[model samples]
Structure formats: structure tokens, C-alpha cells
Target: MQLIGRDAETGVLEEFLGRVRAGESHAFALVGESGAGKTALLQHIAERASGCLVVRVEGVQPEADLAFAGLYQLLTQLPVRFDQLPAAHREALRTAAGMRPGSLNWLAISLAVRHILFAASDKQPLICLVDDEQWLDHASVHVLAFTARRLGTRPVGLVFASREPSSEIAGLPFLKLNGLTDSAARALLDSTLAAPVDPAVRDRIIADAHGNPLAILDIPDEPLGGFALPLVTKDEWHLDTLPDETRRLMQVAAADFVGDPVLVWRAADKLGIAARAANPAIEAGLLELDTLVRFRHPAMRRAAYWSATLPQRQEIHQALGDVTDQRTDPDRRAWHHAHATPGPQEAIAAELERCTVRAQSRGGLSAAAAFLERAAILTPEPAQRARRLFAAAAAKHDAGARNQALELVAAALAGPLSAGERAKAEQLRDQLRTATSLMDEVRRAVEAGGNTDEVCIESVLEAWRGVEPTTADDYAKAVLYNGIGRHDAARDAALRALHTPLVITELAEAAARTGHFDLVKALPDPVGDWASGIQARIDALLTEGAQADAHHRDSITYLDRTHVRIELARAHLLYGEWLRREHRRIDARAQLRTALEIFTSMGAEAFSTRAQRELRATGETARKRTQPNHNTLTAQETQVAQLARDGLSNPEIGTRLFISPRTVQYHLRKVFAKLDITSRTQLDRVMLG
Candidate 1:
């Protein structure tokens, strides 16, 4: 049938292809329910993609257990010159494909895939289509997703069609395939039918199908009321009604996954089943018998395989296992044999455990986890099962399935683990918890401006103790040292973290405090309001009189527009000191008093004492404020206050902090109350300046 009801989606693809032809790379994902035209749309794009090197692979469900299976299929289609790649990348790809013996580095493989695609795209624009991405092997999908996201400026376009959306590829543009429009569904249904239907029956069918094209065309011949199945349920009811021999044949075909006719026929012959048994299923529009024994839909194969009794399924697996060529495909044979064995079998479990090692060697953490989990189920000994489960949990954790890893670890811990095993499992659990906790703490600290506190820094440092230091940790240390009046250490740390936007303000402050004016002058122009404020402060100290006055004014204005209260107060104090040197005692007193009031209220005694000293120089002894309010800015309130002062909308602030806009509004209410301000406009005068 001609593809229908996707003009907008097709237009997007056309434009995307146009861009690819113009030497800009792009990636897109097609997300939809089963049979909601993802495959059809992908094929449509491929057909229209003239002059492009199109490479496509359909993720086979049965092959998902095989490490790098989907990637192997894709690479085999490419005209890759392995010799052209960097030596490490070449070795990584060769090892992954079993062409060379070496440890598999998934990162190296991902990078190599990118190099290969970019090289190909230099000659001709490339279109890569992955159909049924949900069924792709975990390792292959990860590498492909990684490559797709990093394909900047290359003449390539990657399109993935999947029933379920994956977060790993969530960065790619997604076209969600909902049902066809009413008129379009009618046109499609009319095209499929040989005879005209009554209008009432037609409307009923349309409503039942919910505009799903597959359901509209494949509605059973029986009366609609008793035979209708939703798109989600698919054709399970129809599969159930087939003759017993046909159902058995369908099951056998389903079990011969990848739809290889030779495997299906061989297994059937062993079971003494005639090929004619497939006729009933083919007549029912559920099976397509040709060179490959295939199902009409992926759902149909699932229905066929699941419709069989456990014992019948086991028999089918055994028959398939007996016919499988072990020398050529030991993994498939072992998998089938494992399925055929009803209870725990040590030999089969050992074979599956060996498969885990092979999968792990290929950098297939998820596939290894699957094998280990299955082996655990098949291991007769409780201690061995516990150990296997723990190993699977570690693999799962490495694969980024955090919750599943936690559950598996908990299961392992509850079993009869030895002291060492139990300690290791508990450590894994602590690591998982700490991972999440540290992320939350860092986000909270950044948003709340609480990273300056000694207690907060110590807590984070303790949590991060044994981990290798990242650039982010360097940034954190910069902020920590700056807060503790360690300018030299802060400047060193800030220089190490100069690449990040958030470190710009800290770097400027630390460099200026340590008499490194030349360092600030050599830095790039600041972007954000806070960074500009700090930059202006540095400029003020390097200039004189009117220029100095203008820089200080600009510094205060810019600081007032950001969430950095401490920086803003520092700006006010610095400007006051400059005004004092200029003999503008009246202006200096105003600026110094404002700084002293804010610093004292926030319990920043050091800055407050400096402000008091500056005030004394201006012939005014500033009164000490009532002891600082213990109920000053809270964690969330401080974040909201800073963002609001910085001129961000509630929605934007909420998005930054991963909270709802209403929650942002609620936090803002508390912030305004804590800062003793009624409107955001007053934030600059009271908190920022």
C-alpha cells in the first residue's frame, strides 16, 4: 500500500536530506506504536534519498542477545577501508567484528564508526536507517546512538525507527508517528478493500482502529464486535483461531528467528511437520511463506511464539537446537538448548556463563548482564546463583541501567553470599546511592549558592574522596578556595577549569584578588551578566577617574542583574573604595553602607567587616546589624532568588533546576519573603546590589 498521512514528516526528511547534501549532518528518530508506519516511512525516505549511500538494518529480536549483531550488519553493508582508520580504531573495529583478537573498547568502536561514516559522507551523503531499533543489541545501539549525536557538519543523516523511545538517543530529533487522519484513514482503507462497505460499518471500523493504518487494513473477516482487537493487542485472537497444525508451524517459524527458511524447514522436518501446515496461517494473512518464512508483522511473530504452551515451545526450541550448526553459530545453538532445558542444568548454565565472558569481551555490558542473569537462573547451586546475580548487577550498572542494577544487587545480597561478596554488593549499592546523591547535591549547591559554605564543601569532598578529579571537581575546588579566602589556590584551580561558563566569574575574582590583572586582560570577553560584572570590576582597578567611575557603575548594574549576591556586594564595596579614592565621600558612604547592610544580614562577616572599614575611611561608623537571620535564604529559595534577580522567567528557572514552574513560583514566594522584598524589581536593590 502507498504510504499516507505523513506529508509533514516526509517534508522534514526531505529538508534533512537537503541539508545532508549541503554537507551538514543531522539525525532523526521515528517513534511510534507497532505498525504505526515507522518502517514504511523509513522505506519512503530511503526511496526518495537519490544519490545517497543508503545503509539500512532491521533489528532482529532473536539477534539482540548477540553482541554487536546490529552493528555488524550495518558495517558489512558499508564499503569501509579499515586500513584508512587510526591504528587503535582499526584494531577496535576488527576486534568487535571477530576479525582480530583483542579486548573490545566500546568507546574506540564508537569513535571508529564515526570516522568511517564521516569518511564515507565526504564522498557522498549517507543515509543510515535502523528499523525496529528497540530490538537492536544493546552495544550496537549505544555505539550507533553515540555516533549519531556526534556527527557534526558531516554529510550524513541517521534515522531510527522504534516502537519505544530511548533516552540514549533522545538528543536526536524525533518524529512521533500517531495514527492517520480521518479522511486519510478512509482513503487507505478504501484502497485496501475490494468491495464497498456500508457507511455505518465504515465509521465503526474507523473508530475501532483509532486511525491506525495497520488495524484499518487488517481487520478480520468476521463481524467486528467479536473479532476486533486494539492495535496494542495486535492479532493474538486471530492467531489463536488457526488450526492446531498451522499454529504449531507458526510457532516453529517464529522460533526460527531472523526468519531463515532453511532453519525453520530443518527444525520442522525434525519434528515430522509437513510444509503444508503453514498454508492455513498464510491464508489467514499472518504468515508470508517464500524464500524466508516470515510473519506479516513483528507482533504476529510475538503472538505466534507466545500462543504456544510451554512444553510445545520447549520442543520447538529443542528441534531448532538440534538442527543449528554449532561450529558456525555456537551462541544460537547454546541459547536454543538453554531454552529447551526445563530445569537447572549445570552444563547449559556453564555454557551461558562462557557466553557472558564473550559478550563482555565485546564491550556488551547489557548483553553480558542478560547472559549472566539467565545463567544465574540455571545455576543449581544457591551460592553460584548469588555470585552470578551480583556479576550481572555490576554489568547492568556499567550499562547505565541503574535501577535494574540496584534490584539485582539487592537480590544477590538477600541470598547466601559470603562475607566478601556481601561487602562488595553493599559497596556497589553505596556507590549507586552516592552517584545520585552527589549529582543532587551539586545541582542544589549550584542553584542555591551554597557551594561557598565550608560545611557544604567538606561534605561534597568526603563523598568525592576516592574518585578521580574531573574538571568539574576543579571548578568546585576553585569556588571552595575563593570562599575560604585562599586566592592563590582558587586562581590555580579556576585556571584549570577555565573552559566552563560558570567558572568565569570565579576566575576573574580570584585573579584580581591575587594582583593578576594581566591574566584577566588576556581572557576572552565575558558573556553572562555576572561574568561581565566581574570583568568590569577588574577593568575599574586598571583604569582611572571618569573611566574608573563608569566601569564601577557598569559593574554594579551588571551585578544587580545576576543571582550572585556575594559578587554584587563585593562589586558595591569595590566601587565604594574607588569612590573614596576619588574623594567622593558622600557616594562612597552610600555604596559602602549598602554593601555592609547586605553582607551583615547574610552573615558574611568578612565582607561586612571590609565594608565597615571602607565606611570608616568615608568618615562614617556603620552600625552593626542585629545578628544574622538564621532563616535567611534557603536552598531552593536562594536558587530562585538568584535566577529571578538574573532576569530569568519562572519557567526558565524551573527548567534549569528541573522543577515545575509552579514550584518555581512557590519557591520565589519564599525567596521574596526571606529577602524582605515584594517584587522581583526590588531584588536588585535589596539582595543583588
Candidate 2:
């Protein structure tokens, strides 16, 4: 098939291929909607590229949760020698491909895949084409994305086609395919149709197709002058013309999403469908039988699946569930079983909950949220559903999806719940609100003439009622009181929360206004390299001697973790205040400005005000300025950029961050775009300035 209206995209692919042939590496993502010719473009590249070993794999929806399914498909097709890789890598690959009995180690598997691809590319230029990448199993996506990013000096070119945006490959170069241009659309139409139609009908078909090549070809030749139909509707109409058994088989295939012919055939066989039933679908150009069975276009697959009756769809899902291998593909089997059960099923819900936990352990927060959300839907009892919904909300919130978390919390609240469950749901809601409205909440509390000590005590008592007090709870109380200037209460709470001597630094700082210099002197010697301990040592030195400058530098250097961001900001604020007290006005201005930026960005109104006061003491005006867009880079991106500015290569950055080199490059690209700068030299100026 000729690719129409993708000359520019094809050119980019060709250039990448050219680079690979010259022993340079490249990776690109082709992003577009259904019927946007992504598949066609990939096939075009595969056919046109010369002197390269092309390995193609596709994401199958039905097998999305079957870990490493896509990677197995790609690796099995290549001439891979397992003996060439490290034993860990070999074992991981063997486990992933179901050839060995062991847990799947994604890192080991990623390394194995990279080593295999590197060896292959050394023999011949290699091209990897991944189609429908959004449907790829999470494990496979991670490994491939890792390998693609670290191709480095290898003669490899990686290309992916996805219908949805994916954060896994967020920073990769992408070619977005839109609709075909007018001339290209018409040319495609003329080539696709053997017989000429009325000019008016042709014009109408062109307009209705809206430049989608597949939509244009699917239009009926006998269309009347006044007739109109939606693009996918036309494709669904064509599906309606197929025989019952053939159509049902196609519907089953569509629902399979993985488009695996074996699974589809097995499911169809259960429905009494013979192999011949698939012939008609193939003849209709709506189905293809190759390494995998797939619809000609994503739109046709959607149309086929949606065209089935609800009960029939359930039966198909049940059939798939029955055939899926439980050992190797438990998550998908569980999902299919859940979908097949007409109503709530406790067993399926429990299985999905387990899946959610596994996903969370892998840092797949979105996947964990999805699993919990689906588990909630499958829960039979109202209270169980409410609990599941609350769990899902928590997972979503942890994943940085606050809006979705709020929506889930609202849904949980509407469900039948016990008082405890309801309270938990309300608490989650309040937490999310606090994160987004910290400044507003502080202002409201202040305006209402709230006593900081009373409010802090009440909050802690109410939330932790009937439970043993924990170090974390007391710490929260201490922070809350300290924020509102209740030094005595804050000191008391901090002392209670001090589980280890390392935490004495934070407590000492909180108790500074309470004349607790004796408490500071009573602390034991530091034990470990904990940040809290480090900060405390710095604080003790600053308090007792002329080492405030050195301590300030040391405290700031240890402020790296996300959990300690507030402490980092406070360190800057206190250091700025101390600098001002010492008449180091210029240095105080720098520290106070940093503290103000951090506090304002975090919506810490009280801390921001403190920093602003210090700034003014340094003879600087603290203006209420809107946040800069350049500061919107995610924490990971900022880290990557900072490491890059420190002259670390992609692999070095990846090692330090515990991510893949490709991932570092991906985040670096985002950082570059966010800061509107193109190079590492520019990054130092933008970040350090």
C-alpha cells in the first residue's frame, strides 16, 4: 500500500534510517489518532528501508497486562544468542518469555534486550518498528523505551506508532500525522477506486471522509447526493454486511485487542465458528492474518467491538478468559474474568486488588489506579466498592492525578459506607484539597481567629483517635504548630515525635524560639548519613559557633528528596534570616529569594511570608509575581537537566537517577523545551542564574 500525505514523516524516518546505516542511533515516536495512517506509515518504512534487519512488534490490547508479551514477540523473531548476555539478563529474558521459572526482572530483561539488539546491529543495521505502542504491556514498554533511549553508538533505529500519548517515551522525537492534504486525498481516492463515480458524489465523499485515507476508501460508491454519514459509521456499516458467524468472529477478534489469531480462533471455536468463517472478513479487507490477526484499521476494530450485543460481548470475554494461560498471563486473565462476570464478583475484585498492589510495587501508579478502579467496579458489596474506590483515589493522588482522585473520592462518598470508611474518604478529600489550597486554607484559618496550638492538637487527635500515636503523626502536629508560630506547643510536639537522635535537628530548629538551647545541647552525637541528622548537625554548628555559612551550605546540599522539599525551603529561609542578622545583605537576598520562590511555588503562605520579610530586611522588594512557565518542568526533568549541566552523559545521569539512559534523554528534551534553551551550557545560565 502506498502511503499518502506522510511525505514529511517518511522523510524523517528515512533520515533516521540513514543515520543508523552510518552507525549512528536514533529513535522516533509517530503519534496520531485512529485512521490516521500510522500503521501504513510504519509498513511503508519497513518496506522502503534497505540494508537493515527490521524487527516489528505491535501492542495488543488483550495482552496489555501480559508482561513482556510485546518484547517476547520482538526478541523471538531475532537471531538472539542468550549465551552472549550476562546470566542475570539471560535468566530475566527466559523468565519473561516463559522459558524459565522465575520472577521477571525488568532491569535485567532491558539489559538483555539491549545487548541482543546491540549484537545484532553490529552485524547489520537494525530497525525496530513498534505499532500501536499505547497497547503494549507495561513491562515491554519500559524495556523497549529503555533500550531505544540507550542505543547510543549502536547502528539501531527505533520507531514507535501510538494512538495515545505515553509518558514512557515522553521526550523522544515525534512525528504527528494529521489528515491527508486535499491533493493527496484525491489521488488516494482515484487510485483506490477502479470505477469512476459521479463528480458530485466523489466531492461529497471527499468532504465526509475529512481527509482520512481509510475513511475515503470505505465510502460506498453508490452513495446518493443527499446522503451523509460519520467516518467510523461508514466502516461500521460495511461490517454490518458480513455474515453472522464471520461478523461474530470479527467482533471476537476486535475485542481481543491483542489481535492474536490463535486466541481469536480458540474463542471463535468455542462459539462453533469454523476457520472458514474468518475468510469473509479477510475478503472484506477488514481483517489481516499474518504473525498476528488485526483489523485493517483501528477504527474498524472499534466499530466491530461496539457493534456486538452486551451479552455477546460478555460471552466473548468469558471465552478469552477460559483460554488465557493463568500462569504466564494472570493479570489479563483476571481482567477478562472480571469483565465476563455479568455483575460484581468478589473473587475477581480481590484478584484485581492484588494486581493493583503488584503494579504499585513496579512504580506503575497509573496502572495501579486503573486496577483499583476496575476492582471497585467489580466489587459486589456497597462498602467494599466504597473502600476500593477510596483505594483507587489514594493511588491516583499518589500518581499526581489530583482531579481524578477527587472525582474518585466523590464517587466513593456516594457509595454506601460505614462511618469509618466515610471518614477516611473525607480525610482523603481534605488532604487533596490541602495540597491544592494550602495558602487559602492557612489564610482562612488565620482570618477565623484560630488558635494554632488548639487547631493542631484537634486535627491530630481527631485523625488519629483510638489509634496509637506514631512518630509521623506527632511530626505533622509539630510542623503545623510551628507554621503558625506556636513555638512552645511546636517544641513539645517535636520532642514527642523525635524517635531517633537524628531528628533532633528538626526539633531543635522548631524549638529555637522556645529558649530550648539546653535541648539542643542534650542531643547525642550524630549516628548515620540521614538528611535529618545532617541538617541537625548543621543547625547545631550554626547555633554554637561561627560556622553558620558552612552549615548553611551543607544543609542546602543535602536537600534532595521530594519528601524533604519543605525542609529544604525552610533551610534557605532560616539561612537568609541569619544572613540578614549578620548584615550580609547581598548573600541574604539570594537565599531569601530562593526560599520565597520555593515557598510560593509550594503554596506555603506562612513560609513565603517569612521569606518575604527576610528579603525586605535585605533591602529587596518582594513582589507578588506570577509563576514562570519555565519553572513547570517536572521534578524528574529538573533533576535530569541539573545533572546534564554538571557534565553527566545520558548514561551517567540515568545511573544516578536509577532510570534508563533513554529516559534521561527524554526528560532532558522536556527540560530543554520547558526552559526554551537548546544546550547544557544554556541550562547552567537558566538554572543557576
Candidate 3:
């Protein structure tokens, strides 16, 4: 196959191979969306790796739970001599590969793989390519990640291709492939077509493809005039032509999100289909068979599943549910049961609810939200469904999927609810809305023509009327009074809301703003790391130069929670104001601009406006606020730049951030490029300007 539109990616792979040949080790992850040429790029690298000993493994969903599945595949391909390794290393590898009777040890397996790869590199530089790393077994992923990190100066290269995000690689260097450029897509289309295409039709195809090379080639040769091309549906193009049995197998494969072939085949066997029935689809490029069955792309999986009738899909789910082990994979079993039961199955809903709890216990908020959403769909009672929807919304909110959380809240509101449930829903809606649109909410509250103090007091009284008032309710009252210029009342309400450390910090700020300096000093120490953070801000405001700077640094190091990110933003704003007063205009401008960027991005309208005012006071015109650019420096980059400007060297910055000096240099290089400056001296001007 002729590869097109991956010059930059191919160049990076070539460089990695060159370094490996020169006795240096390297690891890179190729991350992109499905059908974005990740697999193609990996294949191109393998073909071009002339003298290197290449070993390849592709992760299968069904085998993800099978210990050492990916690692076993890679190790088997290497010409390794078992007798050459140390006895412990040899036994560990043998045990992990199931050639010996012993439990698998993670450290021994990792060391064994590392030693084998290093030994192979002495004969020829070794290159290990792992495709679809998201589906790799947890054990294999951990071992390979360990080996990749410890390669040191060995002549080996580890490269991975994944459609998922960078989380799988654990901070390994990665090259992300976006859609091809317009010219590249056009050139690919030109070469792909057998006959000359009409200029008008060509233009339409180019536009419809949207720079995806695969989509452009998948366009049919029929009349193109007035014909609509689905942008992302090309992966399903040839599926309808497959045999019924093959198509059925594809649907079953699609039904399992993990693509576990064991479960798929088990379900297929229950349906009286032979294993050979899936070969047609596999040959047609619609599916692939490894340790598990997989669709060629995620879109194909969706197409296969959606193409089946609801009854047919329910039958497939029933088969899968029956075969799935209840104890070993209760989440998957519950999920299958939820889908298999037609409507309003209380048993299935309860099972999914239990799964949601388990997911929450593991800190999988997104997974918990998904389970609750499914439970809501399967719930028979109206009130129970409403509660599930509300719970799912809350989980989504905690997971930072704010827009989806609001949508779920709206869905919950449309259903039946008791008065308390209704109040909770309304409160949640108000809280989420206030976080993103405080200015709008405040304007609406004021325009209602009620006395600000009376309304604030009424809200507080109504909230307290409940069996127990929540901190949220008290915080709302504080914000309402603060927005209306009732500083004393705001301070009082803020103090009442001091339940969590975050709320204590909020109260401290409100007290300081109301000229209650004594109250700020007298505030009880908040629990957790935030105690240091809140104290740091208080100390910065109350103390002198060097001590104040130390406080600010401590505050920055302790700020991590999303809900309290605004406090971090406030710290930067206060630090900038202090620097400006001290005539450190350059440093002040950088800090002020960072605060403005964070405030605007978070939709804190009042604070962002305040930051803009501060920037102007520092003698730099605040440009008209625009949507944040995706390419702009990240929060970590901004922090690193600020610390560097404060006269910290790479090692000092690394110590403060808890990263290696090399990592610090790497981040600085990226910071310098993003700010379009050559040296640290230019950072303040370029970053602030």
C-alpha cells in the first residue's frame, strides 16, 4: 500500500530508529483518532526499520484480562535464549508465558523483558511496536511501561500506536496525528482514483472528506453531484455486503465494548454459529481476529451494532449476559443484563445501581455516571428513574463533564419528583449555572426588583428551614450578597458556610475583602493541604517581601482541586498586584495575564474583569478577550515560566514541581516555542504581551 500524508510522523519514527542504531534508547506513542492513520504510520516505520529486529503485538479487547497476553506475544517473537538469562529472570518469563507452573511476579517479569530486549539489541538494535495499546492487558501495559522507562542506554526503541489519549503511555514522548492537510488529502485522492475525476466532483469529495485520507478514498464512484457524503460514516461502507453470519458475528463483536473474542465467540456459539462464519467479514476488512475480535475502526463497530434490530440486539445481549461471569466481571454482566432486558426491569436496574457504586469506589466517576444512566433507563418507577438521573448528573459534574451534567439535570427535572427531590434538582441546576454564568444569574436576581438584603436573608432563612442546611446553600447566599455589594452580610454568610477547607478559604477571602483583617488573622486553620494554602494567601497579604513570596509559592504548590481553581487564580491576581506595587512591572504583567486567562477560561466573569483591570494597571493593554486558543501554553507551562522568571534554575524548578531536571528542560523548550521567544530574559515580555 502507498502511504500518503504522514511525512512528519514518518520523520519522527526515522529519528527514533536512528537514535536506537546509535546505541541510544527511545520510546514514543503515536496517538490519534480512529482511521487517522496510526496503524498505517506504524506499518511504515516497521517497513523502514532496515537492520533493527522488529517485534510487533496488537492488543485485543477479549484478552485484556488475560495476564501477560501482549507481553507474551512480543517476547515469543524475539530470538531469546532462555539459558542466557539469570535463573530468576528465566523462571519469571517462563511462568508469565505459562510454560512453567508459578505465579507471575510483576518486577521479575519486567526485569526479564528488559534483559531479553537488551540482550537482543547486542545482535541488532531491537524495535518493539505495540498497536491498539488501550486494549493491552493491565499486566502487559505495566510491564512494558516499566521496561520502556528503564531502557537507559540500551539500543532499543519502543513505539506504540493508540486511538485513545496519552494516559495509556504514562508521559512517554508522543506524536499526535490530526487529519491530513487539504493538499495532502487531495494528492492522496488523486493517486487513489483509477480514472480522472470531474473537477467539480473532486472539489465536493475533498470538502466532504474534511482532510481524512481514508474518508476521501472511501467515496463511491457514482454521480457525485448533489450527493451527500457522511463525514464519519465511511468506516461502515462495505459492511452491508458481508454474509449474514459474518455480519451477525460483527454485531456480537460490536456489542462488547472491550471486543473480548472469548465472550463474542461464546455468545455466537449460543446462537448456533460456527467459528468459521466470521472469516468473510475478516477478509472483507470489516473486522479482525487476534486473541479477540475487533472491528476495523470504532465507527464500524457502531455501524454493526446499530444495523441490527432492537430485538436482535436484545437477543445478542441476553446471550452475552448469560455467558459473562458474575463474580469476575460483574460490571459487564450487569451492563449486558441492562441492555438485554427490554424495558423497566427492576432486577437489572438494581444490578446496574450496584455496579455504579463499585465504579464510584474505584474513583471511576465517568464509569459510575454511565452505569447510573443505564440504570435510569432500565428503572420501572418514575421517582427512582428521576433519582438515578439526578445522581448521574451529580457524578458527571464531579467528573468535570459540566455540559453533560446540566443536560442530565434537565432530563431529571422533566420527570416526576417529590418536593425535596424537586428542590435538590433546582439547587443543583442553580449551582452549576452560577459556576459558569454568575454574572447572568446575579443580573437576573437583581432585575427581579427585590431588596438585595431581604432576598439574601430570605434565601438563607429558607435554606435553614430544612432539616440541615448544606454548605452550598450558605455559599450561594454569600455570593448573592457579595455580588450586591453587601460586604458585611457576605462576610457573615461566608463564615457560616465554612464546612470544607475550600469553603474556609472562600470565607477568608470574603473577610479580607470586607476589611476584616483581624478576622482573617484569627481564622481557624483549615484541615488538609489547603490549610497551608489558605494560610499562605493570608500571610502574603499581611507580611513583607521575602516572606510574602514564600507564601505565594506554597499556595501554588498546594492548589489542585477543580472547584477551588479560582482560589489559585486569585492567588496569582493578588501576587501580581503586590509585584506591581513593588515596581516589578514585567513579572506583574505575566502573573496578571495568567490570572486573566484562567479566570476567562473558567467563566468567572467578575474575576476575569478584575484581572483585566489589573493588567491595564501594569501598563499592558489587555487585548479583547477571545476564546482560548487550543495551542496556547497549558497551566503547567505558565507556572514553569513564572517560576523561571523569578530566578529559579531548571533543577530548582524541578524540585518545586517534583519532576526531573530533564523534564523541566523539556517543558522549558516547549514554553519557549509556544511563547515564540529564544531565552528566559524574553519570557516576561512575550508571555505577558
Misplaced by over 4 Å in model 3 are 1-235, 360-363, 414-421, 436-689
lDDT of each prediction vs. the true structure? 0.73, 0.70, 0.71
- Model 3 root-mean-square deviation: 25.5
lDDT of 2 by residue, 4-76 (tens): 7778878887887889899999998999878889899889888977778999999989999998889889988
Residue 639, candidate 2: how far off, in angstroms?
40
lDDT of 1 by residue, 640-689 (tens): 78888999999898667644455467567756766677999888887753
**Candidate 2 backbone collisions, by pair:** 61-257, 62-258, 149-662
- Candidate 3 or 1, higher lDDT: 1
Question: Please, what are the lDDT tens digits per residue for candidate 3 over residues 1-689?
Answer: 56777877788888888999999999988888767888888888889889989999999989978988998899889888989899999888888878999887889989998998998898889999999998898888889988888999989999988877336485898898888887898999887654344354465456545577667777643222211111224344566787888888888877765556788899999987789988888777667766645555445665787777889888988898889999977867787777888778888998988877654543246667767877888888888999999988887787656677888898899999778988888777756764444333333333222224433433432221111223346666565454333558768877776552233444556676677867664336444444566677777766778898777766655543213445556677777777888898987776677666656654555566667887899898657765434247766577788888888999899777644354456568768866778899888787662
Consecutive 10-residue window with the lowest summed lDDT within model 3: 222-231
For candidate 2, the lDDT comes to 0.70
Ranking under TM-score, best-scoring first?
3, 1, 2
* True-vs-predicted CA distance for residue 102, candidate 2, Å: 83
